[model samples]
Target: MKRTLISALVAGCVGLASFAAAAGTVVVNGSTTVLPAMQKISETFMAKHKDIQVSLSGGGSGHGIKSLMDKTTDVAMASRDMKPAEVENVKKNGGEAVRFTVAVDAIVPIVHPNNKVKDLSMQQIRDIYAGRITNWKDVGGADARITVVSRDSSSGTFETWEELVMKGERVQQRALLQASNGAVLQTVAKNPNAIGYVGLGYITKDIKGLTISGKAASAETALSREWPLARDLYLFTNGQPKGDTKTLIDYALSPEGQVSVKEVGFVPVPAKK
Candidate 1:
């Protein structure tokens, strides 16, 4: 009887060890715009799949792409599609970048709540960032000089702004360069004369979102592509993802994962027909 009991105890211990070893870890690194949603999804995913671990980090979209190319991370989150050059570089390194669109977002221009300017035409916004419109009064606001706050070159937010708002023109040298959408939101929130832009998910009551070309930035408009600044948020994997990587990505695109997107202030991808 004693021998049988000891054998059963030893078998139980070995089974527990095997279960622990089966747990998988997935590393995701990328856009700050996508960071909040990813963090929430990771939390929810891990809660359900207790054996899986998900780690997330933000260093702008460009840095994430580089990490993927260097084979340091399992997934790369991006607010914009990989540029042609970036795709070529990844291919040259013997990796094919596959993109998955997870959500929709709008680059909403924001200002201090005190700023009276409510709406800006497309040309007016272009001129403001290009240094042509130096004062808020030029766009129907206060007489103070416009303190431009902008994202850094490495940011996908900045690239999207460059394409939609700047239109090949450059943001003025006078603009303040911030590293993330959170930084831009904070800077604009605190300074009454400052104007900046951020992902729709980053908008808060602390800063006022300015209407672009008479259209308000919202999930409805963004998902429908009616918002002029609307863009797709993405996750990139080298070739097709398998195992834990595929599991995480699949979860992110699932209905439950899409709920996390809406909870975090971004538009969920529509359900498949």
Candidate 2:
């Protein structure tokens, strides 16, 4: 009888150890634009879910989606939706990409705080990016050569800019291409003649956000769809997120997670009325 009890206790301990080992870590990779909010959400989540670990990294949205297709990441943070080709590629790789819209953001044109240009029409902004308006003076700024700063092609921010501002045209080769939104912000803030576009969250006192058609990029404007460059921020998962991946996503969509969205300077996804 004692032997039977001892054996049962040993099996119970083994089962408990196996359960603990089954708790896996979640890895998130992707868009720099979504990094800030994800970082905050992860922190809050970790505080509550001490058993699970969450890791995050930024490489542009394209890279993030690719990582998901490759099965390297549990989640992909994107500032834009997956492209058609990307959707097919994930399917071919034995995975389906599922997107969850977590927040709303606007791509705001930024310049050095010292820049005098305050407002630009959509056409003028388009002309500047296309390298047609090469001088700040042409756009009502000081007489200095316009230095165009742009996000790298892999960036979702760049994709949104192409769709909204460039239309079918290409950004001129003369433009300086930065890899991430933060890089664009830093470049624009440092160069008085430089102009770049970044997610609205990145706008700081060091850089001045340009008024598009006399409308500033703000949470109210973005949520109301009054900001011309407004777009949805996404979290992509392979297949329909299950296990820890689902838990993390659920936390991000929770009321507390939406609060983190607002605290991070981005607009939260609105609750159903």
Candidate 3:
């Protein structure tokens, strides 16, 4: 009975294995950062192709890659590129992991709207997350202790943050870890002293997006790779997609689908001239 509802958008937190593919169904699983835009795109895709069903879910990027190697999902949405070991694992399964860039994203640091501190230097951000700077006053805000919010390790957003922001240092043990972008957003939005990072698409009025090192996060900066935390969003398949899989990927990269990407606050892949 639950499977009959496959055409409807399902929660990203649901277990991936719970979904069984039918003849015309396409199972998409992966990064929560990419989930919102894909949800919008899938709705448009399904509307035009009434005979097809698209099931979307999120469990972070690693889970999506694992599902692809396990032959459980048709398409894996990721906010970061596949690591070499992940690619090798697919080869062991007699398949090749192929990536299609669907959009560009900038990981933006966010804080509660009332937080007076506006911009943070890269070194200052590193210090705060590393616990070197524990109070908001240390970086020019109130004297209260700062609460650090972070995405769980399995997330691609975490991996990107670790690479571009943390460098060699680790986030301190005291930091609160959330499972999804939406979780991080809500946690920070409710706490005046909390600071967290999320994909640019997740930025909303509930929280204020902070400029990192004097550069604001925006589509122009992300598309040009001028933003320090900018990265490409991807759709990965077990191999060169065929049949319905190819059709879906094609539509996602089409101009029409790119419009949906922009509408969702992500930077669309530049069209080929």
Would you list the C-alpha lDDT of every candidate in the order shown? 0.85, 0.85, 0.88
TM-score of 3: 0.94
lDDT: which candidate is best? 3
| lDDT string, candidate 2, 82-195, tens digits | 989999999998888899999999999999999999999999999999989999999888999999999998999999999999998999999999987777877887899999
TM-score against native, each model: 0.91, 0.91, 0.94
Deviation in Å, model 3, residue 261 alpha carbon: 0.4
Number of the top candidate by TM-score?
3
lDDT of candidate 1 over 1-273, digit per residue (tens): 122322332342232211111249887887988887787788899999888887667778998888888877889999999989889988999989999999999999999999999999889988999999999887888899999999999899899999998999999999999987777887898999999999887877889999977899999999888899999999999889999989999999999999988887889999889
Question: What shift in Å separates residue 84 of candidate 1 from its native position after superposition?
Answer: 1.6
Separately for all candidates shown, the number of backbone clashes (residues 3 or more apart, or on different chains) is: 0, 0, 0
The C-alpha local distance difference test score for the whole of candidate 2 amounts to 0.85
Runs with alpha carbons beyond 4 Å of true place in candidate 1: 1-23
lDDT score at residue 78, model 2, on the 0-100 scale: 93
Q: In model 2, which regions exceed 4 Å deviation?
A: 1-23
